[model samples]
Target: MDLHPGEQILFAGRPSWRSILGFYVLGFLGAIVVGAIVKAVDKTGSGVLAFLVIFALVLLVGFLKRIGTTYTITSERLHIRRGLLSRSVQQTKLERVQNVNTDQSLLERILQIGTVDFDTAGTDDSDFTFSGVANPDEVVAAVDRAQRLDPPAAS
Candidate 1:
């Protein structure tokens, strides 16, 4: 979606490769299992096609998800858009942001990718989380600065 006039985007990002690595791993292991089963049972490569089909499906879904999901930070708000066929968009005003956090697991820390969480002032829970973002500390800093900026209405 286009931003309103006078609004400037501070940051735009997607979930990092770390977030979707599971899908690739699943496809790989599944193909191996299918190959083993076919080797043991058919020997004609009957289930080989099944493995290819499953792998293709998983790969497609992962690609589409990575391509379709986006997290955007604007001077006025934080916006997240996700979905392939149907888009879901959520935005919280900068003035409402209560806290910004970056979370990283041991593996993620090693990979240098993390999740950025945003908690708005009135919300009991985080308004949104950008998972597996590369260099999430920078994003968190940008979000913190944005949160400190006055909202359009206030200005």
Candidate 2:
């Protein structure tokens, strides 16, 4: 994570650990219930094996996705970097920011985690989504403050 000249990070964080912990709790419980039903019906262990395989793959993906992602808000821009096997970096200048929004689904609200979305000027779609981050409103406020700063003139 390098910054351009004079660029300073205001807020930097990854997704909440609480959400991942909650998901793991629910996922294991659901898998146990499903595996139990499959075990009763199938004489062989094929159903259990299948469930285990799928569950493992899902966990692997979630783990990689969670660990590989980084979200950053800086004085000049909002930056997102995602993925390990395949990487993508996206940045939107603060001066171009049109709107800032926060969304929390029922579960996310309960968990006190949500996504902060950035809408940059001239883009119909959201420019960035800082998902599953804690204190989304705080992040939104930081972004607002950053956007208020007079953007440096482009060379």
Candidate 3:
């Protein structure tokens, strides 16, 4: 199913707030760990503060990048567009898809969201992953439907 020339959109649903929250929580934990390590080694309050500032900056950039990123399932293929400075666009045809996997962490389960990983035939470490997707079951169903409608040809 080929998407029309200019018909791309985000995933079927919006990103889960729970996903965003989890990202922030992880960022906070990372900041703490980095700060602690710096403090233990350097024994300087300024080093910890510097680590905290740097961690916060990295997290902020990641948050903005996540917000800017989008996943599009077109009639023909799945499209992922992301990044600011070094933008990347990946498109995988439905017929080329070999497998699909949905994963949910304990936190994702509580939040009712997960990530969908796409495995395309003949690809080398180039699987497409849709992160922070809401209602992963629905996304999986959609992917299955797409795959069933257009299975890959035998090699």
Best model per TM-score? 1
lDDT of 3 at 21: 82
Residue-level lDDT of model 2, residues 34-148, one tens digit each, is: 7777878886986688579667866876787788889998998888999888999988778888778899988888889998888788876554799899989989989878877
lDDT of 1: 0.83
My TM-score estimates for the predictions, one after another, are 0.87, 0.76, 0.64
What are the candidates' C-alpha RMSDs? 2.2, 3.3, 6.0
TM-score of 2: 0.76
Clashing pairs in 1: none
Best by the lDDT measure? 1
Candidates, ranked, lDDT: 1, 2, 3
Report backbone clashes per prediction: 0, 0, 4
**Residue by residue across 1-155, what tens digits does model 3's lDDT show?**
24565444324544555678856777778888888878888875966796679778867866776666777775458877777678887877777777889999887898888989989987885658888888888877777666555433445
Candidate 1 matches the true fold with a TM-score of 0.87
* For model 3, the run of ten residues with the poorest summed lDDT: 5-14
